[model samples]
Target: MSKKPNIIVAEDEEYNFALIRIIFEKEGMNILWAKNGEEAIEILNKNETIDLILMDIKMPVMNGLDATRIIKKINNNIPVIALTAYALPEDRAICMDAGCDEFITKPINRADLIKTAYKWLDQ
Candidate 1:
């Protein structure tokens, strides 16, 4: 059997992280939580097998954009999906510039989230 996809969720909000964790866990994927960009980077450094990252834009200690940049440097192949409450065009552009492979707005939809995750994971 194939191994479960490992995903890191870099979000400061406990509720948000928990919601995401519940959603992904139901889909049979492995989920890791990081409260900030620094922690996310540390997790990535320690766990090289991470397949994806769900990065929140406005995290404390280090923002998702900064984290995405550093993460790309560490391993450009792993996909990073930017998650933000802001839906502005500039926000999407900024995320793309920071090296995010995809973008998803806040108040996440279960179907959309699963579809995007599967797309990136090639499931």
Candidate 2:
């Protein structure tokens, strides 16, 4: 990509967010960290240039599923990927139902994270 892709990572855990920030920053992507879904929504409303979102399903306030639903309503064109620790089939189904374009189970594989982001941003 010629321009750096701006991405929102909605996660509550500090350690998780830090790890993600380090990895994505290394890829030269512009990363915005949101502690909860509410903050994510706020950021989304303010920034129209965000290319993609990596949403953590389990958050303290407004979980990723609900956030994804609201986000789709605001901007359906932007891809939202569910990044969560839940690996069950039902979890994936729930994320899909909530408008997540993709699902990544934690602990996230570095290659998968980069590959998925590239796929969505490139498309």
Clash tally, candidates in order? 0, 0
Which lDDT tens digits does candidate 2 get at residues 1-123?
A: 899999999999999999999999999999999999999999999997999999999998799999999999999999999998989999899999999999999997899999999999999
Please write out the lDDT profile of model 1 over residues 39-114, one tens digit for every residue: 9999999996999899998999999999999999999999999999999999899999999999999898889888
lDDT of model 2, residue 33: 93
- What TM-score, over all chains together, does every model reach? 0.97, 0.98
The per-residue C-alpha lDDT of model 2 at residue 69 equals: 96
Q: Give the top-scoring candidate (lDDT).
A: 2
Q: Report the alpha-carbon TM-score of model 2 versus the true structure.
A: 0.98
Candidate 1 RMSD to the real structure: 1.1
Off by over 4 Å in 2: none
Worst 10 residues of 2 by lDDT: 60-69
lDDT of 2: 0.95
Model 2 RMSD vs true structure: 0.6
